[model samples]
Target: MIPLIEARGLVRIYEIRKGPFSRPQPVRAVDDLSLSVMPGETVGIVGESGSGKSTLGRMLLGIDRAQAGEVIFDGRQMPPLHSQQWRALRAKMQLVYQDPLAALDRRLTISAQIGEPLDIHGIGSKEERKERVRELMGAVGLRPDQAGRYPHELSGGQRQRAVIARALAARPSLLICDEPVSALDVSIQAQVVNMLRDLQEQNGIAMVFISHDLKVVRNIADRVAVMYLGKIVEEGSSDTIFQFPRHPYTKALVSSVPVPGKRLQGRVILQGEPPNPAARPSGCAFHPRCPLATDICRTRTPELRRIETGRTAACHLLANDLAVAA
Candidate 1:
């Protein structure tokens, strides 16, 4: 079956200048990243800050232009940003931001914000839109009485639910949730996560969930993609990647997640900080901090290759494992 969304060879760059005399250096925020999400499937992208996870999400949605690569929704290439075709396509894709207050309008009431998409797309009549807003409120676990309140009037969790309701008002096929639950309290985060799962199961919505929380991703994602310096270093089923990570970077990340009843005695703690994107290392971007790095890893870039039936990793050491397994 064709993927609901596919990103191919995506590259996003940003230019930054430190001083008046210095030249603007180009930083590759996303580099040659490829990923896909099937209908009703959740693909979790996990990485530290500045790893380009959020940039990749924006590029996937066409909110940010890529210097190279294409995003295909369903089967066709995505339309150019802000084009008439793209405007029409927007109705089928939505973004849920990390901060609900920032995403919601301070002046608009919750009901108005929830029904705004319908008004913009001209989806239903006034009465129908009003009823739909109420239904959406209930779907996201919001009370109908809170509909008339402004964003400031609602709690953080309630505001987030309002934002989600608005995103779903148009019935989007794809939802890119960037740190959707990171800002909420732990208890609220679980509620929202469960709600997201329920919504996806009911509507068969495809999702790209980007977060730094490995445990959260492991809970909600069918597949997990571990990113480093804008490239996907490892990709596989959540269970495989989390339980038996092949890449050193992935292993380090998984080891960091605290396991109950287990001590942190032999965790694979990485040594150095992530290299600056503006000046990435020559071969494997992760070699500088990887404990298993060899001379070959310092001189040659490893392509992402299948290591198991449904798992892939971009590491020189994994190549030997593949040969042994073969």
Candidate 2:
């Protein structure tokens, strides 16, 4: 089956201006990345902050145009940003912002905000839009009476639910959720994550769930992609990748996820500072911090290579077993 969305060789670069005498430095937020999401599939992208996960999400949605490569949606190339074609096509996809308070308009009631998508997409009449808004509120676990309240009137979880209800207003087939539950309390995070999973199952919507939390991603994603320094170091079925992470970066990230009722042992502690986009290291971008870094890792960029059926990783030491590396 054709993918609901496909991004090939996506590259997004930004310039950092320092001073009048200094030349601006170019930074690649997303570099040579490719990903695809099948219909009704949930793909989780996990990485620490500044790994370009957010940039990739914006590129996928055409909110931030890639400097190189292309994004195809439903067998068609993504139209130019803000074009009439893009505007109309947008009804099929939606974004769940990380901060619900910022995402929602304080001036508008929840009912109006949730129903705005329908109005923009011209999906239904006024009465029908109102009915759909109520339906979505219920679906996302928001009360009908709460629809008339402003964003600040609700708690963090309630605000997030309102955002989800708004995103579902047009019945989108694809949802690009960038750090959807990162800002919520731990308990609220579980509720939102489970709610998102249930919503996807019910509506058959494909989702690219981006977050830094591996435990949360593991619970919600069917497949997982681990990103580091603007590239996917490893990707596979969530069970396989999380249980047996291949790349050093992936291993470090997975080890950091806490397991309840047990003291963690042999956790891969990361070294050095977080990756600097403005001054990206040469060769393997992860070598500076990877414990398994050898001479080859410092000199050559490893291509993402297939390890087994439906699994791939970019690492110089893939031939050796992970135990040996440790």
lDDT of 2 at 264: 62
lDDT of 1: 0.91
Distance (Å) between predicted and true CA of 88, model 1?
Answer: 1.0
Q: On residues 1-326, what C-alpha lDDT tens digit does candidate 1 reach at each position? A: 99999999999999999999999999999999899899889999999888999999899889999899899998999999999989888889999999999999999999999999999889989999999999999999998889889999999999989999999999999999999999999899999999999998899999999999998999999999999999999999997788888788888888878889988788767778766898889889998897778898899988998888889989888887633121
**All candidates: TM-score:** 0.96, 0.97
Clashes (N, CA, C under 3 Å) per candidate: 0, 0
Superposed Cα deviation of residue 200, candidate 2 (Å): 0.4
TM-score of 1: 0.96
> What TM value does model 2 have?
0.97
Reference-based lDDT, residue 212, model 1: 97
